[model samples]
Target: MPSSLSGRTVLVTGATSGIGYESARQLSERGATVLVHGRTPEEARAATDRLIAAAGADAARLRPVSADFARLEDVERLAEAVVRDHPRLHALVNNAAMAAPERHTLTEDGNEIAFQVNFLAHYLLTNLLEPALTSEPGGRVVNVSSSLHRAAAIQWNDPQRIRRYSRLAAYAQSQLALTVFAADPRVTAVSVDPGICATGLLPLYGHEGMPAAEGAAHVVHLCDPSTEIVNGAYYDRSTRVAPAAAATDDRTVKRLTKLADLLVGHTA
Candidate 1:
């Protein structure tokens, strides 16, 4: 791990708000070049400006990128742009996520909205950007997973939950898949439950929570080269912890990868 982040480059998804936004700001201030992702180009640019104005972040260190996670095509385009421009990406903070809606809604891509946005989209994007994610020792992926995953199970036969739907269940399933993804051998990655934070997903947690920065700190910690990490490991804040039993199961990771590839129309 390098003592300084000056030469590193990190891409943070969902950087318009919450923990994602704070993570981008903190990383930029630490001297790392950050690609701030949002759902739209306007939103991405606005977030970049806000970081400069409010956090005194260096404008030169922030790059704005956009993609609507609900659309797999958009994710592919986003990956193409990143791989073409940043050939040696140092880290990827897979922080973009959305709660399942009250009703079972499906995207035009024909998958549950939350499932596509929260997990499948990242799954596709990461695979597409493989050429860019550096193979260097400190390079890795950080999945902003949730503790709620402990209570959820992957509805394998009906991943979209077409017959039965619970917003909380849907959200939890997505988080669980993300945790399981860290175990993927294709990439060196780790998942973390940033703790309950007062972000857009706070309602799912059932109470007021800590500031977003506090949660972002846990995420940013893992991004630092100084922090040692084990691929497939899960964390509760700064502590290494076991996640749901299924999250570490080899069969689960392989199964989820196959399912995600099918859902997203991806080959690998």
Candidate 2:
């Protein structure tokens, strides 16, 4: 094991498979105590087993947690549990997100599924876990976003795409909102474009991408304490690049943050 991340703790969401799993594995191997999160207990356990297999003697550093992002209540519970269990979190990898659904689906929270899962749930979780993250020096929050966000507009009046629905549109919008949210000066946050990887989410685009490990590398780099990357910047596979115009607009960021707080039922 590298011991590069020794003594640090990182929570990687969506660790059951693909980039998320690979990210968790890489982090664990690098000596970070990794919390592997999945949508179900079974999935979480399976991911933990895989991570352990990869970590060998360092396997003890991997733990499992599950939460269904489609449900706001479940997201809330997950946040509360993390806050209660890990008081000195060093990093949070908000990597759990689904490809666009075939149709517009609404979560139990009455918000669009993509918006809630990809953006709002993370919005709530980061705020809830802010204390643990800020308590330690060099705390980092890595949000796995996409280059697809370049095509997105907030659609503020119809943020949910309730009137019209397209999987790509919804996914792009959600990613854009997340990137904008990362711009907040309060958190050491950075949004990453994992570069199209051969993950299950790629099938939605009717094609395969690079290997999942390649995509995970982008995330692992950002989490490394040695990286001198600027906070609140967007990166395209290790190279910082300009994000969509909306992501840089201060008014838009604040509006989206306020809207996200309202949607998540949180104040301030």
How accurate locally, in lDDT, is each candidate? 0.92, 0.87
TM-score of 2: 0.96
Q: What TM-score, to 2 decimals, does candidate 1 have?
A: 0.98
The candidate maximizing TM-score is: 1
Name the top lDDT candidate: 1
What is the Å distance of residue 50 in model 2 from its true position? 2.0
Model 1 weakest lDDT span, ten residues long: 129-138
Q: How many residue pairs of model 1 clash at the backbone?
A: 0
Residue-level lDDT of model 1, residues 1-268, one tens digit each, is: 4256788999999999999999998888789999999999999999999999999999999999999998888999999999889989999999999989999999999999998899999899888877788556567899999999999999999999999999999999999999999999887899999999999999998789999999998999999988889999999999999999998899999999999888988887
lDDT of 1: 0.92
Runs in model 2 with CA error above 4 Å? Answer: 1-3, 54-57, 204-206
The Cα RMSD of model 1 versus the native structure comes to: 1.4
